[model samples]
Target: MKKTLPAYLGISFVWFSAHFGGGFASGRQIVAFFLNHQWTSLFMPAFSMLIMGLTFYFSMVIAAKFNTYDYSTWSKKVYGNLAPVMAPVFEIMFNALLVLVTAVAFATGGSTLAKAFGTPYMLNTVVLAAVIFVLTIYGADLVRKSATVVSLILIACIFIIYVPNIIYFFPKIIHNFAAVKSGEIVTGTQNSFLDTIWWAAKYGALQCCAIGAYIVHAQACPDKASLKKAAIVGFFINTVVMYLSYFGILAFVDQGVLKEAVPSLFVVMNGVGGAWMTVLISLCIVIGAVSTGVALVYGTTNRLANFFGRNMSEEERAAKRKIHCISSSAMLVIACWMVAQLGLIPLIGKGYGNIGWVSLLLLTVPILLRGLGLWRFAEDVPGKVAAE
Candidate 1:
């Protein structure tokens, strides 16, 4: 028998794609969470990713140990006897997060293309929704593969768009860095370092919710070591890309980049590249949004399918799983498109913050408390590896 090896790279890319989605790509999340806090922006993103990576590591290890790949089952194990009480609450929180992030992603793609090509926002949103719907129809394997492809393209585009701007605006970034340090350039409502730390924590909690997407793929990891490697790799990917984008956006702080609806597009329009860069970044944003939607939508669809098919036998459920997948995918996608109408900025700024706080209580805190105590026993079984 051929051994099924863990897909560390693929897992890392899935986490990365989910994190570097619409909000991060548009620079809205950075501005809202990190950059808005002024000088704290320099290191806060790294701090946030650290929190996220740790959470992901523990979550994956727990999933691998318990042979529970879905978030619902995984959460129940993590919660132990509290499963009966807390599991349903977690279910609600996870679904709410799915709705919010997926909606933001759709809004991001729609708004990005609308701004880039002067198209109708609704049409753009619907088109983006359709793309995600098709992508989510397949299953976890396809979601993983698509994430790898999208993440590579996004990484290249981010470097392409951000590197030039960072080069061209080096002096401005340096000046702003010093100004922020000296309390001369503060864009945030609160300039305290502790406040920035708090904000980073909140953002970390929100990002931690991506474990819903990742848990389904945890069975792909053959060992706890692979899970750790995936988290560390994911950490570096998120941190480096975040730092680059943060620096690039910082260059425009004095120019009021935060005031713009899409700070990244504003940066590109005002930075090293010209019209071509605009088109490229626009493409980058749309694809990033789609990648996020695909992973998240599939995660939710998986759970929904399991829920709706809970009473059926194995053979019957297998026959109806695809239909369940399609139905759930369509319901979630349509709901998200409607939510996207609330606009991108509001979704990132207002919606994300609230979700972060709630997630910290319902998701992040439970994982940390439970994972620390349970991880020592989470060794992989030799012949019991989950089938993909």
Candidate 2:
């Protein structure tokens, strides 16, 4: 069966959410960096999502051209050796990021647990991690399916409220940003949008594998041409989702309250409505947290298995993959528990938020450089050979 647009769209949105959860969900990381006081943050995620759309388009172009199982070969073929290392090196950093996320999930999840059960958040985190770890070890299909399902719930929750109000929200955000620009209501950062773009460069660690879905899509695509098509469709779907999510949350929230979390968008979201809306969003978030957690563990597992596959037989390689999945999940859960024990919100914001931008920049550079590098170095080779 031909791949449907909805399938690709769902994949793209899930990946973006999986990668940029802390930022995109509540505008915690990117929103704050870009919007700051008034309206700047309000407009930029919309634009950034558009850029993401382009990145998605290009990813397909590059992937199909290379036709490789792992992007490392794509990079190596293009850049010699440098590009091969970009993605995998980053994947290894999961140990640190997992701890951070586990902490936030527990910290925030704790409050929800408390209201719901009068329980400590730390205890809830351990329970959640145990479940996530086990499910992730079982298989990739399970986690991938879970991510899509949870992401849909998230998109629905945002749209249920925002889509109808878009015509209204845009004008207010624009007015607020205008006022901030003119020093009218002390809104939007003086140069908040610019700051967000600059800051997004270094913010990838928190969201490192958020783009794993892109890689997965690229690898599994039937051909390079089909991959580009997938990327194009995927990009728009994701951007639209981000745009709706950005404005939707802002409609019910203000900057001062958002600052309380010191870079958490969910904290802002916690106040996005009355009892029903609150319950709806909160439920979506819990599911989202689970979906993302599962994605992280799975992405890390596959990348590791591929990285070490050269020495193993096909059967050995497949067996190794299972070990990677199971062991990594357990290790990550342990790390999360450790972070939860120490507390993790502020650390994630300050540290992980910065690395995200770097990843974006790093990801594309090899593609550009490797192609150019090969061109420049072509003359030095013993004989001219066609490109891979």
Per-candidate clash tally: 0, 25
- For model 1, where is the 10-residue window of minimal lDDT? 376-385
**Candidate 2 residue runs with Cα over 4 Å from true position:** 1-7, 20-23, 37-43, 56-79, 83-103, 163-175, 192-197, 200-209, 249-255, 262-273, 306-310, 319-324, 368-388
Q: Whole-model lDDT, candidate 2?
A: 0.53
1-388: candidate 1 lDDT, tens digit per residue: 0133247878898998888887788888889898888576678888888889888988887787677777888888877777899888888888778888888888778877887789999999899999999989988887878888889899999999999899988998999989878888778775677888988999999988767888888877658777788899899998999988899999999889988778998998899898898899889888888988888888888888998899999999999999999999999999988888876556355878888888888788878876666432333234433332
Q: Candidate 2's residue-wise lDDT over 44-104, tens digit each?
A: 5545554454455444445455454344454444444444465456444444555566566
TM-score of 2: 0.76
